[model samples]
Target chain A: MSLLGVENVTKRFGGLLAVDHVSFSVPEGAVFGLIGPNGAGKTTVFNLITGNYELDSGSVSFAGANITGKPTHRIVAMGIARTFQTIRLFSDMSVLENVLAGRHCRMRSGPVSAMLRLKWQRKEEREAIGKALAELRFVGLAAQAENPARNLSYGNQRLLEIARALASDPRLIILDEPAGGMNELETAALVNLIGRIRDRGITVLLIEHDMSLVMKACEQLVVLEYGKKIAEDEPDAVKQDPLVIEAYLGSGDEDF
Target chain B: MKPDADNIRKGAYAAVAVLWILAPLYLDKYWTDVLNNVAIYAALGLSLNIILGYGGMFHMGHAAFFAIGAYTTAIVNTAWGVPVLWLMPFAGIAAGVFAVAVARPIIHLRGDYLLIVTIGMVEIVRIALVNNVFGITGGANGIFGISSPSIFGRQINGVVAPGHYFYLLTVFLGATIILFSLLEHSRFGRALKFTCSDEVAATGSGINAAGYKLAAFVIGAVWAGMTGTLYAAKIGFISPESFSFWESVIMFMIVILGGSGSIPGVLLGAILIIGLPELFQGLQQYRLLIFGIVLVVMMIFRPQGILPPAPRKYPVDKLEKQEVSL
Candidate 1:
């Protein structure tokens, strides 16, 4: 069964339909890619799925459970985690602390228990730290765990964000332009990290402008243009499709 | 070298603790009383830090909770003869409940908008108390005949001497510091910090941002309310003038001047804001001017506070130098 299903989703901002009748499904443990040009409503689709914006129509389901219009945090707790298109690390916090915060939904201890430091709360806290550390290690950020997030280089900051998202123990993780500011080497490392993330049996849904990374990592691809799905198929087929090519290069066949 | 540094720090803490304990014995009654006021202000500052510092809420109405607590204790004790100490927790609860009710709708307002709304809230509370809404507040004349607080069968009489009250205040201040320190490192505290840093990111991480903000508001309110109980018990009286908007402003200043989110910073801030004014009583006319100048100079030179909060750290296993260095 598909782990995520966005059926007939439509969103409008005044007169402009930001996302118009978009439908797609992401199978479990698969690496899926959504690619489009600037203002193609790619990020808007992410916002709608993550409940950052109210959809004008249609519904989203995760793990066969209807999750449309749920609060963003609640949707996250139900096993869907996402990163922002722009990196949003807790700038004042240490890298490990940022990851530890992502473990908040999985932990049960509240203020009272935390204040008193009950045995179970302490145990949970220790385990959370352990898991967060493991995530940092997975992303090769274990050494920089104590550094303030803002002090990390841009590429490392992006990795820190991914580490934070992975700490939530979600079944599905969405990457919104994770390679936005990355250079060639950094993008190559990010591709390897995404492949490793997929090998852990977590479904990956990515929105990227990096055709190289998307074509290399994603099992399937969805092409969007001007708030509509222009093509959906295997990367090879989608890349060759005239509609996808036209969407990217325009009718005049200019280089894109 | 690390062990030596640790020992020096420990020794410093011991010396400070010893000096605090011996203060009342060596000092005059007036000085001792002033020190006690410093402790009270420190507690209040720490309370406000939880909201304004950690939660990143622009809270300028903490005195309302303090007033609620004072009134709760005053009314409960005067009417039912309940000891002020016994009703202290009730005072905290009252303030906390009041905070939940008042902050629920307006907590979503950010920055200056929230600041304005909180300013209005404090005014509303003060006006309510002045008007003696239910006749229980005793109007602007205030309530009196309040008995002294007895802890473990020993009465703490303010008139007798400052020694016992000094010990009492110290105990309360120590407890507040310890509790706040523990909370500052707790999961809940981290949640509040994350919410403050980035509400959207915190929500994306599955943190209930609004819920944590509300928790911080109520916790700060409860602490302020408890401090109010202490203030009432110490003074044996409370008027609308005591919990004025000026008092709220002073509390806010204490957090900002002493690093907003730093516990030690807040304590130092309290001493400077509350204690220094008393020490400079000779320059009465220029008191406000000096304070304003000091604040401006401080803002210009060291805006983060005299003792800025240190970056939070966690224990790591053998720091490895990775291939791709930042």
Candidate 2:
């Protein structure tokens, strides 16, 4: 059985169907890519999978449990975490605090424990801090930990967003445009970082525009066009698929 | 980054507390009264900080909660003869509950709409207090002959004297500061901060943004209510006229001056606000004019208030730390 499965999932916004009967499965420990041009409903799939929006029809099963209509936080608690296309670090907070917030779902202490600063809670906090620092260091941001997230350069901010998501300790991580706004050099670094994340035994579902990065990094690829899945297969094979190529070229041609 | 020196400063605060607690013994009644006023104002400033600073609520009706607390305690302790100390928390609960109810609906509105609603609410509460119901509240005459709080069937005002009241004030102020400090550092507090910074981002992070805002509002109301109770106890009387829109504005000013979200900044702002006026009693007529000008200038120059929130630091791992060095 697949580790995370989206079977016949559909999402409609008012009169428009944003995701139409999308069905796919992510095999355990697989590095999968979802790619589409603008308005092709790539993000809608991420939204549906992460429970940011409810599926109009069908279901999402993670670790063999349905999480279709669960709240985003509940999904996160169930070991599914995601980063945004727009890096949403807690900008006012320090880099470390932003990641610590991701640990919210994992925390065992109640308000009373935090308020009283109990020994057990303090110990747990120390451990959590150590982990957050480790994740930051892994993302090459350990020294920038004291800086406000807003002060970080764009590339570092993107990395910080990933570190924050990792702090939640999820089994499956979804990165939405992880290389958005990065130059070739930065994209190379992100490709390596995403691989490191997957090597830690976590499954990855990546939505990206950088075809080169996706083709090189993703073992499997799903091509989406106009709210429908046109093809799913090995990256090389999918790149050669006529229907997938047509969808990309067709949308661009039709726009004119 | 080096460890924050602020952490060490907190230790020094404890030593300062020890000294302040003992200094009242050497003070005369006049000085004791001034110190007492400071404690009361500090509590008031702390209360405002919870709402405007930490909660990011633009409340113009905080004085409504303050009025409710003061009246509840005064009415209960005077007419029904409840002991003064017992009256405080009960009054706080009454005001807190009122705030919770009011905030449920009002908090839905954002920005200027929320501000107008709060302003209207304060006006309504104040007018109701002034008008009274069937003469029970004495209307404009206000409740009179209120007694000082008592302990063990003896008047605390007499037994404890002004010096003991200072102790009580210290205890209350200390506890309030400690409680708010813990709240600012908690997960819930972080949720509130996220909401204040970006509501949409906070919601996307799986924080119940609306719920956190409501929590901050209610908590701020409770602080105001508790301070109101203290204010009534210290003065031994409260008039509806005293708890007006200006009173709420003054509270907002205190919070704004102290750097909207900084605890120590709020306390310092309160001292300057309350202290500056007292020290310049000679310029009493022009005092408010000068205060308003100073406030405007401060707003223009330091809009973040006395101490804007500083960026929080996270621990760095060995690799990233080395990367920075390179």
Candidate 3:
């Protein structure tokens, strides 16, 4: 009944074993968090789930359909959208244009209809623009819609990426280090945005190094270390788990 | 003040249109013919722009499509006696079909790899024509004495006046520009731009990157084929030499030097690269050297070209003021 179910997923890059037997289930409308140290394969898990990489073993099911080894774009169209760890805006495009590009999956007008500007195409385009604007407004970027994406500040660019993901009308949205580069204020804003995104009845899954944002926003957490799951529990319990602490601070007598 | 600026712009555009319409009357027959060539090249440049400029594909074999279109016209006209104008659309369809067939297998190749493969494709097509693969290509010498095209049952031979061909080319060029302008602003065009900017991000947005790339190639090929038909009709002859590898190179240069993704820029590029050499006929031997120098200088100075594409804008004045005050 879960929206996304990963069963014994394993991926190896030669002998590295980037992800080893990772399993988790994300319930519908839940904000799930994946936290890990550098090279802990959190991003690799995301890549596997999004079909960006082929899994060595195990299956992934989204919305009750097996999506194992499906192409990235097809997986995205099947109600799952994601942002990158590093920002990947169509930099030369305007902010609104970037969001409109995300709406590409939802629309069906091809080259001939587009070239001829059929009535239905125009109507669909107008609706798409309206929807894109609504998403930009959701992320507080409606005013900067006409500005080129590259011209926006780093924080605003991150928000634009979120808006773009939202425009795809996905059932579940994944955020990969959505708060990678931000001050306290920007991080706080991102947390609020994530909360608003979840409030819209869309499930949220995020990978974050910002402990405060992750702990505040995620309803449940999964911890990984050395490509293996260390702990999976509520935020308060995961924060206090001995394995999670050891993974973050190392096994030595290091300061908390 | 805005209205005055608009008026000035309108006036300038009107003056240019008037000059273009009156050119054949004032210019000599030789110069009129050169203008005709410019129009043809402009159309060809626009065609290549759809792939190289918008789709961000390195298509170094566009001349193959051109040859396909020209040969289809030549063969169909000679055998079936179809009116050259009526056959133009079929020529475009033939070239588009050929493009889909050839580009399907190699559309996955990107950047310089695709470039190398396309260069080989052009050679393959050229050699096929030279060998007269179908016997209908007329071998290396090509077909000759093709009938002139007629609009509304009026023949446009242009043998004596040259104005007839000039008008026809201008109409073709104008129509091409209009059609391309519509496409450049549409959803399909935006998809091509997104694919060009970042293929991975575009795919993540659910764009079939390969499909859009193929569409761009086919559209570009269709345009090139139509231009080839026009070229054959104007010359009343066809030859393997007309659609050479160098011809593809010139079309690529026209798009790049004019600023890729800019419609007006490509037209200007066609005029400069095609028209300038003709104007400097007195310095005939140094033409290639001069072109090289000019290209190098352009690259050093205005690399984005004479008219780089401006940012796209939408008319959403009401929504513009509704920021959340974040």
Candidate 4:
């Protein structure tokens, strides 16, 4: 069953149509890939789904409810959490603190409870710390939980971002270029993590340029070209699609 | 940091705190007065640190809330004859409510825009006091003849003397430090810090960036407002001049100079900022010039502050225990 549905979605910037009437749905518990050439509005599409950008036209529904024009945090609370194309960890904060922040939406303790250290508040905080550390262990950065996030290597930072997103306890996790700048070993680990995330019953929607990883990990794929959806099918079928080939390789008319 | 180093740092903090609570006995009355001022400024600095330091907001109009609190105390006390200490909660509420109203429209602005707006807010508040808005402000001459705070029939004699007010001020400062420290370690504090460091990433992680920003602003305002009551009670008179834009600047500098989010840094900053010029009173006209040079030197030597916030440590061993309990 589809958990997130994007219908006739559109976004524009001044005169440029960043995402033009694109539509897609992410199935529940499936690893979905959003693939397109550079400047194909793949990131823009991600932004629209996560409510980072307002849709110029169209509606997005999650969990059987329309969620168009909601604020980014609200969208995240509705179980759609995403990472940036560029890593954006809270560099000065501890790695553990970074993950705890992801648990922000999940926890209900307020400023008063926090200040007074009320009975339930203390219990909640202790639990949050435990879960935050658990996420760090999941990302294999448990030993560095006390270190500043800036001290992490680039690959570890990517994992940290994932762990942070997962801390929000989202139903659908959106990863943008998670494998970018990763070594072969890191990519393999990410693929394994994606499978693990699915096993946890969370839907995965990712934007990727890594064809090998995408074909290997993603159950289905959506391809875009110049702000329009060109193809949507299984990874094997998408690889053989003529329109996707033209969009990624070159326009076939040029014969280069 | 190593556990031993953390323990040593914590021990040093305890020693300083003990010394601080006991210092009034040894110091002369004049120096005791200086200590009172230091305590008050330290509390105010900690208040602003929530917004400017933890929340990464550029708030320089904190004096507006301070002025509101002082005025609230003056008006309520002068009219109803209520005790000065009794009005602190009222002043904090007034400041907090006003902060919500003021910060609501402008909280979406990022960086320098927010800074400029807050600066304008302080000026507007000061001008309103000077103009005697609502006629209760007593115009440019300011409110006077305010009552001293009393505790269970024991008056501290805060009017025109530091005497027992030193103890009173220390108690206030101690409460402020403890409460603010609790807040700093709280979930609210973590979310605020994350939002400040990176709003986009924070929001994506399901944290409400604008709401937390406004909350930090209001929390800071509420604390500053309570401190205002203390200031008024200490002086027995409050004028528009006391809550000027310069006052706000000094509070901002206190947070930045000490270490934005470090409580100890703010206390040290309050000490140096209030105590240094008084100790170097012989500088006279060149005091500000020397102050500027000192600030420049500080910027070059310790940009992260002399005491930056340390990384938080959690007991990983607890995870095993937590699951078993569950």
Better of 2 and 3 by TM-score: 3
Q: Tens digits of per-residue lDDT for model 3 on A1-256?
A: 4999999999999989999999999999999999998889999999999988999999999999999999888888999999988899999999999999889989988878876778999888877888888899889998898999999999899999889989999999999999988889999988898888888889999998788998999999999998899899999999999899888877887567
- Residues B1-326 of candidate 1 have per-residue lDDT tens digits of 56685577558768878988899989998999989899989999999999998998999988999999999999988899999999889999999999999999998999999999999999999999999989999999889967789978889976576778888989999999888887888889999999999999999999999999999999999999998888898878889999999999999999999998999889889999999999899999999999999999999999989877777655565333322111
Clash number by candidate, in order: 0, 1, 0, 0
lDDT of 2 by residue, B199-231 (tens): 655665556677778877777777677777777
User: What's model 2's interface RMSD, roughly to a tenth of an angstrom?
Assistant: 5.4
Q: Can you give the DockQ of every candidate in the order shown?
A: 0.54, 0.29, 0.54, 0.65
lDDT of 2: 0.80
Worst 10 residues of 1 chain B by lDDT: B317-326
Residue-level lDDT for B252 in candidate 1: 95
User: What TM-score fits each model?
Assistant: 0.96, 0.88, 0.96, 0.97
Better of 2 and 3 by lDDT: 3
lDDT of 4 by residue, B142-259 (tens): 9998899989998787645575898898888888888888888988989898888889998999998999989998999999999999998887899999999999999999998989
- Measured with C-alpha atoms, the lDDT of residue B219 in candidate 1 is 95
* Cα error, candidate 1, residue A34 (Å): 0.6
Over 4 Å off in model 3, which ranges? A253-256, B3-14, B318-326
lDDT of 3 by residue, B1-326 (tens): 56675577558657867888899989999888888888898999999999999999999999999999999999999998999888899999999999999999999998999999999999999999999996889999999978899888889975655788999888888888888887888889999999999998998878888899999999999999998898898878889988889999999999999989998789889889988898889999999999999899999999988878867768667554545221
Fnat for every candidate: 0.67, 0.27, 0.58, 0.78
User: RMSD of candidate 3 to the true fold?
Assistant: 2.4
